[model samples]
Target: MNTKDMRDLDDAELADHIKTVRRDLFGLRFQHATGELENTAGLKTGKRDLARALTIAHERGIDTNK
Candidate 1:
């Protein structure tokens, strides 16, 4: 998802998106460690996406730690 699409999400939805992205990033790391991941670049992309979401959440003053 792009920044524009992420900005369109409400607070709750954005939090959920952050969680999902984090989970996906974790899974990618696991796959890479197991040597089963073909597209290793996904790790980089996932990190950037997570960072974007977190940045947006921070800007909105949303506490995503919950």
Candidate 2:
């Protein structure tokens, strides 16, 4: 998802998306460990997307530290 799309999500939705992305990241890591990952670049993209979502959430004062 792009920044604009990420920005459109409300705090609760953003949190849900974060959880989903983390699950995906874990699966990706497992695939990589098993040497089944076909696209290594996807791992980087997922991480960056998660970071972007978290950054946007922080900028909106979501108080993620709670």
Candidate 3:
């Protein structure tokens, strides 16, 4: 998702999105480590997506550690 789309989400939605993104990113990392990932670029994309969400969360003062 882009920054504008992410910013449109409310607190609860943003938190949920963050959790989902983290899980997906973790899965990508695991796949890469196991040599089962065909698309390595996904790792970079996932990290960037996560960072964007985290940045937005920080701006909104949303606790995503949950």
Candidate 4:
């Protein structure tokens, strides 16, 4: 998703998206470690998406710890 999409989400939605993406990132890491992941670049993409969600959350003053 892009900045415009991120900005469209409310705080609660952003938080949920962050959580879901983080879970996907974890799964991707596990798959990569086990040599089951074909697309290794998924890790990088996951990290970037997570970071983007987090940056937007923080900048919007949304509590990420939730």
For every model in order, what is the number of clashing pairs?
0, 0, 0, 0
Candidate 3 lDDT by residue in tens digits, 1-66: 999999999999999999999999999999999999999999999999999999999999988888
Q: Please write out the lDDT profile of model 2 over residues 1-66, one tens digit for every residue.
A: 999998988899988888888889999999999999999999999999889988998888885543
Q: lDDT by residue for model 1 over 1-66, one digit each (tens)?
A: 999999999999999999999999999999999999999999999999999999999999999898
Task: Order the candidates by TM-score, highest first.
Answer: 3, 1, 4, 2
Candidate order by decreasing lDDT: 1, 3, 4, 2
TM-score per model over all chains = 0.96, 0.88, 0.97, 0.94
Per-residue CA lDDT of candidate 4, range 1-66, in tens? 887899899999999999999889999999988989999988998899889999999999998886
Instruction: Look at candidate 2 and tell me the lDDT of residue 45.
Output: 94
lDDT of the candidates, in the order given: 0.97, 0.89, 0.95, 0.92
TM-score (C-alpha, index-matched) for candidate 4: 0.94
Which is superior by TM-score, 2 or 3?
A: 3
Global Cα RMSD, each model:
0.6, 1.6, 0.5, 0.8
RMSD of 1: 0.6
Colliding pairs, model 2:
none
- Count: clashes, candidate 2: 0
Query: Which candidate, 3 or 4, has the higher lDDT?
Result: 3
